[model samples]
Target: MKRKHQILTIPNLMSLFRLCLIPLIVWLYHKKEMYGLAAFTLVVSGITDVADGIVARRFNMVSNFGKAFDPVADKLTQFAMLVCLAVRFHWILVPMCLILVKEILTGILKMAVIRKTGIVEGADWHGKVTTVLLYITIFLHLAWYEIPDVWSIALTALCTAMMLISFILYGIRNLKLLKNRKY
Candidate 1:
């Protein structure tokens, strides 16, 4: 059990900042010329995300609110960036829809696991890898709007595959947790 959690911690504030960047990212994505600005803003958001985690752990400022809120911020940012990219890259929808299903099923399973195990499960390593791949794909598309068609498709496929893998792994873990729950 960790201590020193409070609502006003720096990590929570960083998560809040990331959440607030969504609209700007979306708007900039649409403007075309502002893609650079959008990419820069997204980079800042990503940096803040990494910093928040480091700050949270290093400072022992991890709060329940932050543990919940950080993932929400990450998901929203990814979703927003994907939707913005989907307009230009139709293949982006594959991961977007896959993530939609993944999140929904995982959300339900997470709740059941928590009820059975009485613990809020943190994200696993596969989930973190998927997140990184998703961000990389998004940034590539944004930063290199004219990226060769083949590369775009390849990256999208890779991101989708990673998400699918993580989805299955998370499902299995959650089910096992439910099965092994102490009654």
Candidate 2:
């Protein structure tokens, strides 16, 4: 099973576009005070995220680079949104920090696993659900300026809890993989 490293594939291009949207979204949300455009950018990024995966699997255009690049783009976009929102909603910082920590630890574990076993443990159902919840939470914050402060805080806390659960599950899976490795 020779994995390709092609860079010109459709999915890779879509992932790159999603990465490009991060800065634009930040500028719109923070500098220009264009919440509508910012929210739209996020929606587009999310659409592309799903589209890339479908195209990759449907067209058999999956590559090692795509496998890695797609998730990096997704995380960066999510982190950018969190940072932008945290400027206004301080509670967002909690989930932002948790996500940062989770990404750092899981990223290291993932690389170690790939080096040892040549297997990339992609996003599980829990991780995907966490991502969806994060997106929904962000959208609620962005789209509804009238949302009560308490509600926003509660949603952010819920997102944080789900993220923590995802982090724990990934950690357990990685530890199991490490334990099974033959020294």
Q: CA lDDT of each candidate? A: 0.88, 0.88
Error of 1 at 164 (Å): 0.4
Worst 10 residues of 1 by lDDT: 1-10
- Those runs of model 1 whose alpha carbons end farther than 4 Å from true positions after fitting are 1-5
Per-prediction TM-score, please? 0.93, 0.94
Clashing pairs in 2: none
Model 1, position 162, has a per-residue lDDT of: 97
Candidate 1 per-residue C-alpha lDDT over 1-183 given as tens digits, one digit per residue, 9 for 90 to 100: 445447888899999999999998998889656888898999999999999999988988877768768888998899889888888889889999998899889889988877778767778899999989988889989889898889999999999999999999999988888998732
C-alpha lDDT (0 to 100) for residue 141 of candidate 2: 81
